[model samples]
Target: MEIAVVTGGVAEIERDAGQGSSMEAEWLALLAALRLARRQGLADFVLLGDAAAVVAQANGAVRAPGAMAAHLSAFFVLASDGPAPRVRHIKRTQNLAGIALARGR
Candidate 1:
């Protein structure tokens, strides 16, 4: 699993294959991004990612699967008990930069 948190063009990334599933990783990454932003005193932020299921769950547009339900719940708690850092899903083609960064290429 690889996660990137970008703010002002500066990106902070974390990778953990130790985590079981991609959905879990996405949820964890989203939670970590929000926590990082809040700890850095960043407000009114936007979170972009390539995971549609995770985005929908985070945005309350759909229910999270059992594997990621708890992870999503945790994100909501950190996001002021609701959505924060507005999440948007992008096409994988449009996410080349993030993919390259994640691959360290």
Candidate 2:
């Protein structure tokens, strides 16, 4: 999975070994991004990605099912433990930088 943290319009890319579907990778990336932001002393952040389902789950629109349920639960706990976080979905073309990084993975 590839995660990009955009703080002040500048982005830093990070990657992890992705398992399962694209949505899973996106969810994992969201978790990782939030953790990274907290480590950087960020008190509030927004996560932008191209995965619709994952974004929906993060935004509490859809239920996280199967293996993702645990991750989703963990996401909420970690998020509330520190900074305020927002997750958003964007078009793949608009997320080209992350797309390239994910493809390389």
Candidate 3:
């Protein structure tokens, strides 16, 4: 099975927004990685996030359980046979591309 690593990067705003969480951006970033892999016809892939929470969410960790949990669980089950992909976590320093994308630089 072909494996792809979907990685994300994170940065703190020196000038804090203080209200809206940047989680949406991170979420979009995860989607971006997933989309890229899909475009390449790669079904088996892993998602790596800067934070452990993101990784666990993608990998179906047992914390903060919700619809995402159920979705990921189901996705993994189906993908296991239908070109399964894996999701994991990586440090921000390790995700250079994602960092750049996040920074919009």
Best by TM-score: 1
Error of 1 at 14 (Å): 1.8
Q: What is the alpha-carbon RMSD of candidate 1 to the true structure?
A: 2.5
Q: Write the per-residue lDDT of candidate 1 for residues 1-98, one digit (tens) a residue.
A: 77666666666777653656767777777787788778878767777778899899999999987878888778878888444569899987666436
Summing lDDT over every window of 10 consecutive residues in candidate 3, give the lowest-scoring window: 1-10
Better of 1 and 3 by lDDT: 1
Best model per lDDT = 2
Quote model 2's TM-score: 0.77
**What tens-digit string does per-residue lDDT give for candidate 3 at 2-104?**
1123333333222322333344344445555565666667655675677566566666555434534544554454445445456667787877555554465
User: What are the TM-scores, per candidate, against the unseen true structure?
Assistant: 0.81, 0.77, 0.54
Local distance difference test, each candidate: 0.75, 0.75, 0.51
Off by over 4 Å in 1: 81-83
lDDT by residue (1-105, candidate 2, tens digit) is 555655555566766555467667677778877887888888766778788888888889999899889888989998888766888889988775475575666
